[model samples]
Structure formats: structure tokens, C-alpha cells
Target: MSFPENKLTVRSSADLATAVPYLIGFHPADGSIVVIACRDRRIVFAARDDLPAPGTPAHHLRELTAHLIPVVQRQQPITDLMIVGYGTKEHIDPALRVIDDAFTATGLAVRELLRVTESRIFSLTCSNPACCPPQGTPVDPTTSLIAVHATVAGLVARPDRAAVASRFTSVDSTGDVIRHATTEATARKAALETAGSTAVFEAGVHAVRSALRQHDNDTPLTDDEVAWLTVLLTHRPVRDLAVDLTQPHDQHVTFWAEITRRADQALVPAPATVLALTAWRCGDGVLAVMAAERALQVDPNYPLAHLLLQALHAGLPPSAFEQATTSTHPNPSIPNPNTPSEQE
Candidate 1:
């Protein structure tokens, strides 16, 4: 995630420690490693992954290095990086060395290497006790200016990654209501199909527009409305229209997230993938990855979800979708329902 340059800066280890959570949208777990890439002193990309087990085999470390190197490499022109490992030195050093060696071998400078714990942060490269104390420098993000700036800039540092993931979790209380609505929606959709592809496409487009308006108005969609929209989203053209209409805004995130949660099990992939795309565009990689994983869990062969996962893994910026977004027609082409299809 990129931050507003004027709002935040990292001048010291303490500041860097305070900024990590805001960069990734959550506090790193005890065994997590966060890598931030910078170009001309501005953070351009940041990602977090679990540290390999202490006794993990060399091949396993190699695999971990392989997975991470490409992600950083994809952010071309990165002059340096800050690598923070969250755990005790014993737990973090092994994987930290492997990663440091890998990046150094690739000719990229490691600007800082630090090990962080709940109470303090230790600079691995500095031995001068006067500055980098043996006991470590104390860290309290709650009192940090960086934290204040991040919050003022509308960035949220969730307690942990699980807290971020929980936003997309299904609501149990709505299950019975949605299930009943789905039954009625299914019957209605069958009747629309009988009227031919044109009718189905028009109805689906209308559903998409209406649902978006309701969300924009801060009006909750009725269970039947949510069910009908979810069913129509299963149509490829209708799903594409939803994608075209999604903007890189927090309300878009809120809208698609609610739809994904309320959608029937078989109908989740479309809305979930749209949620993923919306989150990514909003520069919330943590949320994007979670939403994409949720979709793939429901439909392993989902094409758009897989595409999103690939782009994310490759560290492509959200601007990569700029052309497609700008060129999108307000109205999507009508699909021939009779066309034999692969997975939608």
C-alpha cells in the first residue's frame, strides 16, 4: 500500500516500526515478515508473509525466497527496502538472513533489517548501544506521530489480519432469509430464461443498476433483491457489467462486501471477485487477497478471481487496470445464453 508522502515519513527505526501496520492495514502476526519497497524514498509497495519455521529445510526457504523475490522485483526501480521481522531474533534471523541474502544477490540494497517484538524494535545492522540499545528501543504506536498522521489520512490499522478478513465473513442471522429469497429468485430466473437471452440480459442489467443505487443511498437491499441480483450476477455479461461499474472507493468496497456475504454459496464467486478488485483498487492489498481467497474457496475454477490472484502475486499496481476501466462501455454487450460455454 502507498501512503500520501506529505502525510507520513520514516526517519528512524521507531518511525518505521510505527508505520508498518498502517502500510499493510494490520498488525503483523508474531511470525510474519513485512517487506516494504521504496523508490526515491517513497513507499511504492508493501507485502507481508509468514516467516518459515525455525527448522524449515533449505528447499523450503528457497521456495519462500522464490515466492517473495518476484513480488519485489515486479516493483521495478526500487532503490532500497526495509525488512522488518516480527518475533524474537532466534525465530526471525534464520528466514531474515535467507531473504537478505536473496535481495543482496539481486543487487538491491537492504536499507534496514530489524527484528520487532511486542515491546521494542532492534536494528540488526547497528551495534552501537548508544543508538541501537542491546535491550532494543521501545515502541508504542498509540503515541506515535506516524500513527496519528496515518489515521488523519484515512488509513486504518486493524488489530490483526484476522480482523481484516472478518469483514467478509458471512452473516449467520441472514441465512434463513436469504435462502428463502434464493428459492423465489431461482424460480423467477428460470422464467426469464424462457423469455430468451435479451430479456434475461435486460433484467440482469436493471438489477445491477438498482442494487448499486440502493447501496449508494445507504438503503439496505431486501433479501429478495439481494437474492435476485446474486443469481443474475452468475451470468457472464451481467458480472462484467458489475465489474465495469465498480469504482475505487470505500463505498464500492462496502457494497460488494455486503453482496458477497449475503449471496448464496453457489453465487459468491462473482461478487467476491468484484470485492477483490474493488479492494485492490483502493490500495488495500490485505482485503483484496482475503476477498479473492474467499471467492476461490467457493469456486476453484473462477476465472476473474484467478486473474486477480495472479495480478496481485505479480505485484501489479492498481493502475494496471486503468485502460480497461476507462474504455469500459456503460452498457456491456449482450451474451448469447445459447452459446456453449466453459466455466463463467
Candidate 2:
């Protein structure tokens, strides 16, 4: 049953919680509740309240890039021409690169991208008891956003915002409307949406993992959600590459091809640990070398990429490659002027 807007139908929460295991990649933790989306629909739920802590940032990024991006790419698939507004500046750089690769694979005009922006905010709060305190000096940042939105936008953009609002459906619930930006409810949705608009959450761990246990699992679910679950869990468009990546699931090479096709070494970051993973996943030596060089471009001192390059050079996987790279770009202490580095 659907709950009407503006109220958290108490009855709905229970069913929603029970259904959440069917949405995103949360193994469930004690204190965290997340928005898990299966395809385009989302289920709101807290972790089992019994599991361990949620995943780390790097871990989350790996899982997301490996799982989420593929699914979204399958759908929207537009890159070179994107309009994204995300969390803050720091995540934007690597994030944009990932986005660039995702869309570019779709044959989108990634060489020349356009229009990417972000806002510096996640939460807001008030200093005094009154939600709208009299204008004065503000001590907190969120307080400042509230003041700005209240004093400036309230006066100037209210009418304009109304027109925009009219164009889109107003699905705002009381939870969404009254919730202050500082509240978890706010940070979890609209704020996160505005900040990380570049990457949207899809598929629930609780559900997909269950689905993977057997074929013809839940026949009743929408085909789109099921398709995404299949891809997210397996992660290999090709069975052989997945086997190479040590994923014992499916056989679909498209995943490897799409990921590897972007390996142009000239554009990747240094010390290609991430790139190495990408290459291994895709199993393309040419892309691997390109990625290795790309890493060196960021910092010639990348030990791992250097080692990998050395291994490839010798057609072996031992000290041979490492030794070669070291000799060529030896310790730059005393310095041999002939062997120019990036500075040269």
C-alpha cells in the first residue's frame, strides 16, 4: 500500500524495513539506516541493528564503481554531456574521471565534457530556539545557509522556485519538508542527492545476494531491477574475465571491454593500483600498460605500477620488471642529467 505524501505512514515503515533487504548493498549495521534503491525505486531502512560497522570510503567506492556505475550506464549512458552537482570539491575529481569513463564507453562525446558543479553543504541548523532567528552574526555554517535561504532566496527566488516546483512533481513528505538540513533525514536524501548527484544508489545487497543464491529467484520483481541485480552481483559481463578477477559467477565480457576500452595511460593517475585492478578485471595487456604509464605520469615513483611495467617488459612476473624500471628511473639523489624526468 502506498502512503500519502507528508506523513510517514507508521504501518508502512515495517513493510518497508522488511522489503529493504531487497534493495541496496548494505549488509546491515547497528546504527545506520540508508536509502537502498533497486533499479529506480528506493526502500528506507536501518541496518539489522546487529551487524558490524558500515563499509569504508574506499571500499564503498570500489563496490560502487564496480557495481553501481555499470547499472546506471546501462540505462542513462550519457557522459560527455553531463550536468552533475555533488557532495563537495574533494570527491569531484576522481569521481568525474570515473564518470568520464562510464559515459565515454557508451560512445558519448567524453573528449569534451560540459557543465559540472557542486554546492558546499550537507546539513543546516539554527542557533536560537526560533527556527527563524532575528538577523545577526552567525557562528555556525549551517546557520549561515539557513539565513541565506531565508533572507535572500525567500525574498527573491520564492516565486521563481514556485514555477520550477510546478514543473516537477511535488513528492515532498512532512519528513522531507519539516526536516532541517542538519537532520539525518535531510542529509540522507535531498542533500545527498544534490551533493552526489553524479552517482545514484541502486540495488540492495540484502536482496541481490539472496537472488544470486539461485536462478529464477524472484520472478515477480520488475525485470529492470532484476537485470541490475544480476549485473551488480556478478560484476563480469564475461565469465572468463570474472574468473580471472576471481569472481566465480557469470560469463559476460562486455563489462571487461567497457572498462578496459578507456585505458589510454595518458589520462590515468599515478601508481596505478586502481588501474591495475581495472586492467586485471578487464584482462587487456595493452590497456594495462597504458594505465601503468598513466600512473607514472602522475608520479614516476609509483612502485607498484613500476613493478607491473617491469613484469610486462620481461614477459614475466618477478624482480625482473621491477629491476628494469628501477635502473631506468633510478634513485634520483646524486642525479644523472641525461636521464630526464618529468621536469625535463
Candidate 3:
């Protein structure tokens, strides 16, 4: 989830319950398992997965643990872990027990285990009925402090994960106009190849930026403009240039997502991959996975799509990729202040 840098204090289970939705960028559906890792009282990362069925074997639970464990270990070290399952107590109890045992064997402290239904929260770790009522605490997630703060910060969580996935669906309008445009673009590609690679690459970048700017101001691209741009983008280097020119955050996402829908699917894995990256950066893992699926369906061997698929599978945060991109700068050597010869 894209959250404010300033930390919000979570002093109680109520507070944690309030924060989970914002942390994951959506309200988890029933049968969802959310795992939160924390260090020194601040949440480091949160991951949500679907809980296995009640009658599933032990290996299914182990596979779920395997998925969450790598994410916990990958980004940073944590001192405490919490698990929240969204379902009835009867259905989720077995999964929780398995999770508890897995974490125990891994030597990580399971600080809290909670079950959340539509109306109330049940805390399994807290024995005190006074602090946590035996019947469960009646709380509303929409009115939580974190939810209010998130609204003020302009971070809107989707209602559920499926809603997030719907954003990446391709426009499958196979009408006369779209077919004509695709044919025109294909013919244009042959001429674009003769236009010289450098010129084609530079034009592709300019067109992408212009399209994004127009998109921002609510100006739609003309059919010919879309045709030419789509044709030029088929070249790998030109596509890479367009990827580099995409603006930040949702704007980048919007640009590539529109392109992915409009462009011929068999010819443009670039826009799909860019859409996946932007979605991943925005913490919408559902869209990222769907966008990557679109790309892989177009070209199974596309490296960037495969990389993002692996990343989503491994539960790597977007910041890890950002850090990896910027970590290659050479450090300047510093003179020793304590050198006796230099002091003399």
C-alpha cells in the first residue's frame, strides 16, 4: 500500500485492525489471510493470501507458509509478526494453528492472531476478556483513524482484490475501426523500419510523452496518431524509450494501461510490461499480476514480464526494485581525519 511516510501509532488490536486494509490497499475478502511483520513497533511489510480450505492437507498449509516466509525474510528483519484471517472462527482455526506452528518452527514470535468477520474482531492471543471481549469487539473499519488519515492523503483502497484486477482488463473491441487501425499500423511499421532506428526511437519517445500529457488534460489521441505510435513502439529500443518517458505514479499507469488496451496485443508486450511495473509500483499487486499475464500471453519469453511475475510471486516490495535501480553509484573515497601524517 502507498502510505504516508509518517507512522501512525497502533497501540491496540483495534488499531491494527483499522490499519490492515490501508496497509494492503484493499479490504480482504473472506478466506483471506493477512500477515504483518513489524520491527520496533512499526510495520515493515504486510502480505495477504487466500487461506486454504478447512479440509486441506498439511502440505497446503506448508505451501502457504513458504509463500509468506520468503517475503518476511527478504525485505528487512522483523521482531514481531501478526496474522489476521478474515472468516468465521470455525473455518479459519485450523489454518491459524498451522500458521502458528510454522512460525514457531522458524523461531519468529507470533505476537497476535486475530479473526475478523463482517462486524467484529476475535483475538486469539489475548486471554483477558476485559481487554478483548469473549464475544469479540464490535468495530467498524471505515471509521478508523488510519482510514480517515488515508482519505486525507488521497490514498483510496479498492473495495476488494477483484476490483483491483479489473483495472488491467484489455479492451477486446474487435470492430471494423480497430481492425483497420491495426492493419494501418502494421503497414506503417515497414516504412518506420526504413525511417532509421534513431529517428524512430526519438519520435516514439516524443509521441508517448505527448500522448500522456494529452491524456492528463483529457485530450484523446487521434486514430492516426495512435496507429503511428503503436507501430513505432513495436521496436524494442523504441519501446524502452517510451517506458523511460512515462511520467510518475498513476499517470504512468494510465498511459501504459490505455496503450495496452488500444495497441494490438500480439505486437506490443512493451506497454503491457510498463503497465505491470507501474501497477506494481503503486502497490496494486493484483493489477500487476494481470498485466504481466497479458504480456506473457503475447510473448511467453519476454524477460521483463517474467521478472515481474517472479517478483509478485516472491512478494518483493516495489521499493526493492527502486533501490536496486539506484544502488549502483560509485561511492567517493573519504580522507582519514585521524591520519597523523596528514595532521602534521
Tens-digit per-residue lDDT, 1-344, candidate 1: 23544358777899888998888989898999999898877888888998777777788778877888888998988889889999878888777888999989988888888999887999888899998998999999889988998888778889997788778778567788898899899899999999897777788777887788789999999889999999988887788777766778889898999899888888889999889999999888889989999999999999778878888887888777545444643343743434422322
Which candidate number has the best TM-score?
1
Please give me the total number of clashing residue pairs in predicted model 2.
21
Question: TM-score for all predictions?
Answer: 0.91, 0.19, 0.83
Off by over 4 Å in 3: 1-11, 171-176, 216-218, 317-344
lDDT of 3 by residue, 1-344 (tens): 22235356676787778778777778888899998887766787788889887777878889988878877777567788899999988888678888887887888889999988777888988989998898998777667886787667656678887666556555566445655887887776667768776556556656666776688888887766666777777776666555555555776787677777777656557778888888887766767788888889989998778877887878788777556533542212222223322212
Candidate of highest lDDT: 1
- Pairs of residues at least 3 apart in sequence or in different chains that clash in candidate 3: none
RMSD of 2: 26.3
TM-score, candidate 3, is: 0.83
Write one digit per residue (lDDT tens) for candidate 2, span 92-160: 445445545654565544322211122121211224434323342223323333224323422212222
**C-alpha local distance difference test of each model:** 0.84, 0.32, 0.73
Each model's total of backbone clashes: 0, 21, 0
Error of 3 at 75 (Å): 1.8
- Model 3: worst 10 consecutive residues (lDDT sum): 334-343
Where in model 2 is the C-alpha error above 4 Å?
1-267, 270-283, 317-344
